[model samples]
Target: MDLDSAFAALGDPVRRSLVARLAHGDATVGELAAPFDLTSQAISHHVGVLRRCGLVEQRREGTRRPCRLRTDQLALLSTWIDDQRRTWADRLDALEQHLTDEGADR
Candidate 1:
């Protein structure tokens, strides 16, 4: 997964909304664009950004191409976040311990 591109793609509110909408279920470009005032072509461009980032994918169902969220990529992002959280927590604990020890010595 290209985390850089994925983060960049999600930086836009429109693209973020698209991912949030796709979370519930798959949707065609028309359905995805219904809530927004933008044209379908504009929405399609957003979807293309998501597709390039590996966050969203479209598959043909009859004549319609439905977009679906790629949860695996999301999981990777989640894992990375959790790892960072843990790393920081550990560092903070160590800092607290050092401060306490210094105070006790003085």
Candidate 2:
């Protein structure tokens, strides 16, 4: 997955909302648009952005193409966040220890 594209695509509030909704279950573009003030085409455009970013997938079922959240792609994003968290935590811990040691020497 292209993390940069995925991150950029999720930068939009509408796309984020669509992802959140899809988390519960898959829904057609029409179904996804019901709660929004935007037209179905607008919702479809958002979904297209998600699809391009690998955050969502659409499948044909009869007359409907339901969009589903790609959890594996989300997992990649989560993993990236966790890794950054760990790196920052380690840096802070090292700084704290350095301060503690300096204080002890004083």
Highest-TM-score candidate: 2
Across residues 1-106, which tens digit of lDDT does each residue of candidate 1 receive? 8899998999999999999999999999999999999999999999999999999999998999999999999999999889999999999999999999999999
Q: Which digits, one per residue and each the tens of the lDDT, describe model 2 over residues 55-91?
A: 9999999988999999999999999999999999999
Q: Cα miss at 88, model 1 (Å)?
A: 0.9
RMSD of each: 0.9, 0.7
Clashes of each: 0, 0
TM-score of each: 0.94, 0.96
lDDT for 60 (candidate 1): 94
The stretch of ten residues in a row with the least summed lDDT in candidate 1 is 1-10
TM-score of 1: 0.94
The TM-score of predicted model 2 comes to 0.96
